[model samples]
Target: MRRPLLPPTLALVFALWPSTGCHLLLDGEPAAGIGAPCEQDSQCQAAQCIDEVCASPCSTSAECPAPATCTMAGLCQLPLRAAFVHVGDPATEQWTQAHEIGRQAAHEALPYLQTEIATNKLLASDAASAIDDFVARGFPVIIATSPTLRDVAALKSAEHPGVKFLTCGARSSATSNNIAYSGRMYQAAYLAGFAAARRSATDRLGMVASLPTPSVVRYINAFTTGARRASPAALVEVRWIGFWHDTLPPDAQGKTRERVLTEALLASGCDVIAHQADNGIPVATVAAASLTAKAIGNNVEDACRDDATSCLGATYFRWGPLYTQLLDGIHRSRWPAATLVELGMTLNPAHSTVNFTLNAGSGSSELAIEISNLLQELAAEGGETVPFLGPLCSTGQRDLDADGTPDCLDPGQAPDPQELQRMCWFVEGLVEKQDPADPTSEDRPALVPTTGDCAR
Candidate 1:
């Protein structure tokens, strides 16, 4: 027996309907057309429907319009023109601010280069995904700002040998066409320490830190050593904040800790405070400003907005020129594949952008002069000053290897990479080390100079 003829409306709807495509429903019947509500198979003109949305079936680039490719994510996307990307944490607004300056300079220097910035609290997986996405889009260069993302970059570089990756503030053991590593902040930090020492009043100093990582530890030691060189009677006390990414509560807590530490040091006669802590400046500055008796400022020269203040100058990092240099390298194809690039306060060779700043007040002009001289000496010597190498010893009779030979100062002596990597002892004359287990200690780590070099 023949089936009864379907209604004209139903028949028309079914004819245009797709078996598994997106469609629109009209007048209680299935519909098939663009911009129509759709469901499974019998509802749309296209066989593929997604959440009532209809589109042409696409399995590859040929199935899509020109310049569009079916992404693995199952969507058509425009082809990416840039070949490089940079990832940074937006939370590190201060640090990233400097980096963005460099990015801008880079763009200016290399008008033809393209770059994309990704900001987030990057995880290893997130880094992997970012690299994968970039690679899939034909990007050949990736720059990561945080140390934590280094490993992922290394892994991705290994997986894709043709890609090039650069990491700032991260050191890696792996070497490949895809990786370049550098962390030259130590040079700047050493100079800043000298500036801090030249500005102290009581000769007792304070340093606030964000973590005990090698980079931070190195800066702390260098600062303390520099202070000692300027004022033998100077004592540097350090507090570790235990975190790199500054947070509000802990940051405030670090400030509180700085206040308490400064008070204790002041009670014991400390008059100046400096810090290696990222974003610890606000807290340290506030504490310094709050003090009725002492001077305050950290990395940058402390130039208080108020005239009647004792805020010394501060040391500021400028990243814009450096970024521009890298971009230039990429554009000119002069970028070294596996070399570590170190950028400093010196003018950028390609763009002449200065990447360092100091904010010493007029009262600290003498200190600034001394610091400038020291920097010049260091630069003249090709960055060869080692503050801790000296006829040095701790206050506690920690004699230098029993022969009275200074650990760091003997010619040709340098700390072992491993020891330098895990420094924990406080230098002689410093007040305290932030105890990892002690809640009472500041959230930052303290560093002190030691009396031994490479057993030379």
Candidate 2:
């Protein structure tokens, strides 16, 4: 049946309107093929639009058209689909940004492995929904980039037995199909601590920290232990900001919680400041807070790169190798065994997952040489000279094991992996201030600085 013609203005409006619910163009030139440009799956005959191009789902190269090999993501054109679950703003959060950088690198290195990121998944339910969506879309790999999402990933992994899951910085016990991995970041923190202590004239240091989690506690303990080796008189004062990233409302002075907390630490007479939080705000605040004070950074190298003179050094993570290894495993059909791996220099000597960078402009050449020697010693076989070695006592001197002995590690005795994984106590010489109003008040942990020789 012939339809009636519309008015000129109405005809132009209909012509300009975007076509939807159909894969054919107005001219009816067949259907958009795999190489055709598309904005959505509905616009393509293949029903898959990836990276702005029509793609056909394929499990192997034989299933794809000639000259187009199948990617690990089961797509003819795009690579394997890997998704990273983020809790904070990657642009503003250093930790999440670091993982994002790694994601980009992994995509670059393994063209067969494509990547996607889902942000603002602050709650377990939010992350679970995102993960489920990714799984429904045939994403084979999921990397939960926060400890908070560790349990969420675990439960999802159990539900999706074929999918591989990796949880970063989680101390949880490994499950049958989930891989728990974290870098040995405390080693780098120890190095940064030594540099900070060497640059401090008053032997008083400050650290802006988040919650007292096991990983955070390990970093603080290693840093304090390193500082004490450099200066026995070193005393570390800690301020808890109660979050992994800065998100608090501005104060009356228009300063953020990070800045306000740093100022309070500076007011307490700390000469050098360090931070375990996931941003450079604390470091930048130190630059503006005082002319003589210094800062040590964490989780990223930009701290020293941004202000070499003001920042002594920083402990950073390089996740590229780890991600590459995992993705390549999928490519080779050699998925990693489900277990917990604490990757360190001992395991990754070629390119460490964790590293420390120093600013030569801020410290003397002697200090650099000392740090280099210390790093070599630490990297040597068995970690005998590691900073966590004892004759160490808690600042509060509470009995940890309840065996009627003070919670002190005797000389030549080192903390086992299980004990370190659950450490919530501080070593001696730390001036821990507890604010009942803080979110981390339930965990009243402290830091410690050693006196005299720890070997004694």
Candidate 3:
């Protein structure tokens, strides 16, 4: 059927209307897409728009126009189909904290998109299956929570080259799609130790741990360093429970494993206790119920808020904003291959991925204020002045660098990130203990078991 012709003015307006969407041209307005601003995904030619600016994905800077450089994810905007995977229930502390934070971030940042939290028991096979489901759904970005999923993440990365697998507590820093994401918890640990030392009446700090990986080792060593700085007589003791968590009960000795270790440390006059496992509740409980001991716990967002007086402060994990960046890359369709995110307060405490929260109490009263000032110094000037300086001595009073000079004397010798991550040595002040022989020889061990997580 032929349509009737419009008047001259109406005909001119129709000719100038945007072809992308059936909308009449507005006065002094540029059309959506084709290098123009956009409000949402539906308004762009690329089906992706962020921050009121349309992203044009490209490989090289030359391909991107001025003021828009090629991002780390290789895209101009974040991806749409982003999902988070965890081994534990969403309510669990360390294993599922990312799920809670991810949900919050998605609601605010990617509200138009539906973000999923795929929960599983997280054995090797289960991890593989979870990745398969996400891949089938065409999710370009996956943020894995538990360290137990490392091997599974690697295998799936090989299977699906397009997926970006960002993980916390990863065992390795592989340069492939299995991106490594870690917060400088040692920086926070240093603050926690100083706080503990200030609170300790016995001048001792103890740690109940699951594994002795470099990450864990770094935490213990940094705590020891900070504690010593606060109190010259301060000492640190560590005991690993033979696993990452309290997954197993004790033998015929009526030991819950944790009870046994806590009793032993307290008997030895250890006044402050910390745990490196998932939830900080147990640590808080142990400290509150103890006779003279206090607690320094982690993942406090999930554990310590209820009982503020049980211990000193919590070494909080800040993964939400970090996880948001991974989603941003996924939406932009440009995941970088070999990126390692090592965030610290030195970058900006207001925006740091980790920190300590010590409420005022007689145990940690003015010490918390002192530690806060120390943190400001630690975070200043790129944070090179961290406590594990060289001319540094090891557990046996031997020079850590194996040279005649110590870190304190050298001034140029401080443990760097990789050095701290690979540290297996204890500092000078810690008491000699029955840990793995030659700790320096084995800085990082298997973060998870090969057949664990019910892998059939």
Every model's TM-score = 0.64, 0.77, 0.74
lDDT of 1 by residue, 321-425 (tens): 555545434432334443455433342223222212355333456666676666665554333344556455444423346676434434545555455545444
Better of 2 and 3 by TM-score: 2
lDDT score of residue 34 within candidate 3: 27
Worst 10 residues of 3 by lDDT: 8-17
Residues 86-196 of candidate 3 have per-residue lDDT tens digits of 787756656466447645754564432446777855677877777799889877667677777777787777778666677766756453667777777888888888888
Tell me how candidate 3 scores on lDDT. Answer: 0.61
Query: Candidate 1 regions off by >4 Å?
Result: 1-92, 246-269, 280-289, 292-310, 337-339, 344-357, 360-362, 393-408, 411-426, 433-456
Show the lowest summed lDDT stretch of 10 residues, model 1.
Answer: 6-15
What would the TM-score be for candidate 3 when compared with the true structure? Answer: 0.74
lDDT of each: 0.50, 0.72, 0.61
Q: Output the TM-score of candidate 1.
A: 0.64
lDDT (Cα) of model 1: 0.50
Ranking by lDDT: 2, 3, 1
Q: Top lDDT: which candidate number?
A: 2
Ten contiguous residues minimizing lDDT sum, candidate 2: 8-17
